[model samples]
Every structure is written in structure tokens, then in C-alpha cells.
Target chain A: MAEQVTRKPYVREVPRMLWFLRHPRYMRYMAREFSCLFIGAYTLMLVVGLKRLAEGPDAWAGFLAALGSPGAIVFHLFALAFSAYHSITWFRLTPKAMPVQIGDTFVADRVISGAHYAGWALVSLVVLWLAGAF
Target chain B: MATSNKPIVWGPFAAGGTLTAFLTPVLILLTLLAGLGHAPDLLAYDALRAFAAHGIVKLGLVVVIFLSLWSAAHRLRITCYDLGLRADTLVATLVYAVAIAGTVAAAAYLLRLNPV
Candidate 1:
């Protein structure tokens, strides 16, 4: 039988919702995590756009027209900024997540992250070209 | 210890994070351009419609949307935990449900956009 100790251990409780506000680094981490909300909402907008497209030309046009609203434009701008932040953080973390080994030595962090940047640039160019942006 | 299904969710999270890393910023930029009424010609209603009607484009769209939504859902689940919302089961269920629903809706809509 285990003895029941009468001692109460000291506990320091962190504030529930605002703990991340305690440090600038923590705030940055929270911002990175919070970007997911904007990304998720933006993805949902695409789903809605798909739905409107499926409905026909009038619905699709209306959807586009709605997107041109000031509020929608502002939302898109925020989403853009957040998603870009997500990309930067993701790329910065990738070398840690995936380390390539060649022979006896591992690849440099910059090499791996540089490759991601290169790929991102290539992908952006391809998408822009496909979207008819020269 | 019993096996955990963590990898199943994690696989998509990593893949989607990578995909979104490379692609999402540009996609959002295009949306911003559209919202600002400067969308390129190919993004026009007819052009985009024809593009979506293609089989490959439909598949690509479904994959992108599904993975992005799933990744965001999983990320938000972790974020909620960090924010001291310790009811993980409830949060996971809610977020995963939304991701799954978004994926199904996207697939359904794309399916309706048959070649014309």
C-alpha cells in the first residue's frame, strides 16, 4: 500500500487564454498557429466558389461579384498575408523535419530550405502562367 | 502500449503543409487579384469553368482542397490545445468533421462540373 502524503505541492498556473501573451516568441508561435484559421477559411471560400461554379454562369458571376466587395477583398488580403507567413514558417521548419543524408554527411539546412524556396518559385511561376498571367 | 492512429492524421498534415507552403500563397494572391477586379483572363468564369471541367484539374482541385482543409483542421486542433482547451476529443471531432465535410463538398461540386 502506498502511503498518502499530506504535502501539497506548489503549483504555478499559467493563464488559460492569455499565456502566449507573456513572451514575444510565444506570441510569434501563436500567430503562426493562428494562421491556420485564415488558411482554413480561405479553403472554405474555394469550396464555396466551387459550389457556385457548379450552379451555372449566373451563380458563378454572382460569386465573383461578391468577392469584389470591400469586405471580401480585405479578407482575401489577410488570408494572403497569413498563408504567406505559414509558408515561410513551414519552409524554415522543413530542414528540421526532414534531414537528407548523403554518404557519411547530412545535407546542410540551407540546402534543403533553399530547395524548397526554389520549388516554391517554380510552382508560383507555373501557376501564374497557367492562370494566364505572363 | 496500444498503437495510435496519429500517423494517419500526421501524414496529411505534413503533406498538406508542404503543399500549402509551396502553393497556397500564390493561390491566395490570385484570389486577391480576383477580388480586386484584376483577375487574369484564364480566371474568368468561362475559362475557369472549362479548366475545372477537365479530369486532371478536377482531381488536382479536390486533392488541394482536401489536404489543405485537413491540415488546417489538425493544426487548429493543436492550437486549441495550446490555448488551454484541454477537451481534445471534442475539439478534434469538431475540427475533423469540418475538414471531412469540406472535402466531401468539394468533391461533390467538382463531380458536378463534368466536361462540357
Candidate 2:
């Protein structure tokens, strides 16, 4: 009787140098993390506004006056770009954060993101209208 | 375990994302207003003072403060995890703990009847 040998499946070890470059998900995770810097800066601006409000009317006026400056406008634009990126990506992650279900069926991530965009659009419209922008 | 062992990228996206999440819309509105060249009269300080004096603005302020703080804290927790901070669970707990404390402080400040 001849002895039988059992062969195991071959598994190749991935090179460290190629791992991140080869993985799209890791790249996205990185993009997501970097977005926080803008978030922190914008939050500070709001906090400044709040503090001005706490100070008194003249101070609040001064704050708004400062906001109207060209420099402030530029800052606002930069803030807007980062913010928009954050919102879209955050919504993209919504399915993972809060999985939606209806009648024993799971809703798709795209649907969830779309709904969020629609909702935000409606809210923006309403806010603009209330502000007499339209 | 192999899947979990992969190194992740933790960089500008984290900070940018968090900032963008809360400030983007407000920036847009501000930009549109600026573009219109209609620099509205500065918000009356008396109005804010009045609200603070009355308690409504105080409450609103508190809510905004707490919400924004908590959101930032949560994002920071995830950012730390992405940076290869192995004790993610511990960091997350600490982050939430700080957020809760800040939130409670906000609420307490708002609920006080006396105004200075």
C-alpha cells in the first residue's frame, strides 16, 4: 500500500508596499479622515459667532461685519467645499451607520444617500425662502 | 485576521470631513448672500442680548454647541482609530464621555433661570 499525501492550498503573502495602493477602500477611509480638519475650523467659526452673541449687540454686529469681508468670504468658500464633501461622503456611509429596512426588505445605500440629498435640498429651499432669498 | 491587519490611511480627509459636515451649507448661504452684494444690516446685538436675557437664545445656543461638539468628538474618535490607535473602543468611550459632559454643561447653563 502506498502512503497518500494531502496537499494544502497555496496562499501568497501580499507585499506591504502594494497593499494600500491596491486597495480602494483604504484610500477612501483616508479621505474621510482628512476631512475633519475643515470641520474643526468651521466649528471654531461658529463658536466665535456664539461668543460674540454672548458679548452683546455691538460685538455681534462686529462679528457679522467681519464675516462680510473678502477674507471671510474666501474662508467661507473653502469651508463650503470641505463641508459638501463631508456631507456627501457621510451620507454614503449612512447605510452602514443606520441600515434602513421596510417590510422585511433592506434598502440600498444609494437609495439612502439619494433620500438624504433630496431632504437636504428641500430643507435648503425652505430655509432660503424663509430668509427671503427667493 | 488578514483582512483586519491591513494598514489604513488616516489624513486630511478626517478633519476636512468633519468640518465639511457642519459648515458646508452655512458657507454656501453666506456665499450666496455675499455674491448678491446685499450685506444685510448686522444682526442687532440687543436682539441676541435680549434672547440671552430671556433664555430662548441661550437654549438654542446650548443645543447647537452640544450637537456640534458631540459630532466632532465622534468623528475624532474614528479618526484616531484610523491612525492605528489600537485602543479604539477605549478612545470611543472616552470621546463620548467628554461629549456627554460638555452636553450636560450646555444644558445646565441653558436651564439656569438667572441671566447676567
Q: lDDT by residue for model 1 over B1-116, one digit each (tens)?
A: 99999999999999989888888889888877877888877778889889999999889999999899999999999999998899999999999999999999999999998887
CAPRI-style quality class for the chain A–B interface of candidate 1: high
Taking the tens digit of each residue's C-alpha lDDT, what string does model 2 give over A1-134? 59767788799876443344567987776666555555555555666666666555577667777877887778677766666667878877767877989999999889988887777667667655544455
Candidate 1 structure quality by residue, lDDT tens digits, A24-116: 999999989988999999999999999999999999889889989999988888888888889988988898998999999999999998888
Worst 10 residues of 2 chain A by lDDT: A13-22
Clashing residue pairs in candidate 1 (N, C-alpha, C atoms within 3 angstroms): none
Per-model CA lDDT versus the true structure: 0.91, 0.60
Over 4 Å off, model 1? A1-10
TM-scores computed on chain B for all candidates: 0.96, 0.54
Model 2 stretches with alpha carbons more than 4 Å out: A1-27, A132-134, B1-24, B31-57, B84-116
B7-108: candidate 2 lDDT, tens digit per residue = 222232343343345445754565347444663222345533444556676666555555555566667777776565768879867866765676565555
The local lDDT score (0 to 100) that residue B106 gets in candidate 2 is 50
